[model samples]
Target chain A: AQSVAQPEDQVNVAEGNPLTVKCTYSVSGNPYLFWYVQYPNRGLQFLLKYITGDNLVKGSYGFEAEFNKSQTSFHLKKPSALVSDSALYFCAVRDMGSGNTPLVFGKGTRLSVIA
Target chain B: SAVISQKPSRDICQRGTSLTIQCQVDSQVTMMFWYRQQPGQSLTLIATANQGSEATYESGFVIDKFPISRPNLTFSTLTVSNMSPEDSSIYLCSVVPGQGAVGYTFGSGTRLTVV
Candidate 1:
């Protein structure tokens, strides 16, 4: 079984400041980690993913995530937050060994970029 | 990346009525999935919509209540039967463009409100 945990339900950050949303996972095998954003009344947009190779992965809308194997974490980050960037962020994971398995998503973290 | 178009962006239905959500992909995809996102909650995989085969549902979800149809590789539908207030949620369809793809593309969700 594989599962993802987003420790924070909501994160507040000032505009122009760095923002971080924490995510961690548990899986039997290597994990394929992903981050997605959902704006109000809209579908989810893919942000980035960590399958193999580099520990740091950059994504859409100036967002990035660091995949730390030792910590079992893939935390989303933005160098400078923007008010427009506020949205519901989700962290998902699928077992790389489990062929074509559906992704398991973490309870979403709502990010609020305060101006 | 594949583009998906989902219909019935939002709907208000009477209890006991059914709603069918449709998704059409621009490109052929190997894996398609349906997910439910309850208010302020994480996404839950409803089923894997297999082309030309019965959908494989996750635990706590039954085929009778949530019937799925994937007649071909580019299209799929999910019908919510005997709708109730508990069934009010955002339904989303996702697809993997090809095997070993790092990210999956999602459609604009269908929001169902049962009254």
Candidate 2:
């Protein structure tokens, strides 16, 4: 079974500083990785995905993730964090073998960009 | 991108009763899925809603407990039957519009609180 791990339950970062939310995945085959954000009382919004391409995948709202294949990690990052960026971040993975497989999400990391 | 409209964004239901949540997507999709997110938790896929056939449920979820319906390519429903406080969760609907591993779009979600 494919699974993802978000080690940090909460990451506290000062606004305007760089931020990183760690994510590692385990899959039998190549992994399809994604990052999603959830605001208060809202559903998850897709940020970015790594299907097959460059190691660094850019996503919406100035977010980017590095897909490290050897390390089996897809970490979300931002150059400068904003106060509005404080939200729950989830890392998800699905097996590349099948298109119909549902994504397996990590426990989630609560990003706190303190202003 | 596919847009989904989920009905009854928030609802309070009595225990032992049932509540059905509906998701309507703007475009035709090949795959639809139902997920449950308990408070302070990530997401657990409940089932895959396949059109014109019975839904494929994940482990620890049953058809009698959470019946799903996918009447068409753009619509799906999930019902939490004989609900309890433990069943209180945010139910989300997801769709794969492109039928590929690129990504998926999610509905806003239905927050159900059993009392």
Docking class of 2: high
- Stretches of candidate 1 off by over 4 Å are none
- Candidate 1 per-residue C-alpha lDDT over B12-88 given as tens digits, one digit per residue, 9 for 90 to 100: 99999999999999988877999999998989999998898899999999999999999888999999999999999
Can you list the residue pairs that collide in candidate 1?
Answer: none
Q: How close is candidate 1 to the true structure, as a TM-score?
A: 0.98
A35-89: candidate 1 lDDT, tens digit per residue: 9999998999999999999999999989999999999999999999999999999
At residue A109, give the lDDT of candidate 2: 99
Question: lDDT, candidate 2, residue A11?
Answer: 99
Q: What tens-digit string does per-residue lDDT give for candidate 2 at B8-53?
A: 8999999999999999999888789999999999999999988889
Q: lDDT tens string, model 2, A1-115?
A: 8889999999999999999999999999999999999999989999999999799999999999999999999999999999999999999999988667789999999999998
Interface RMSD of 1: 0.9
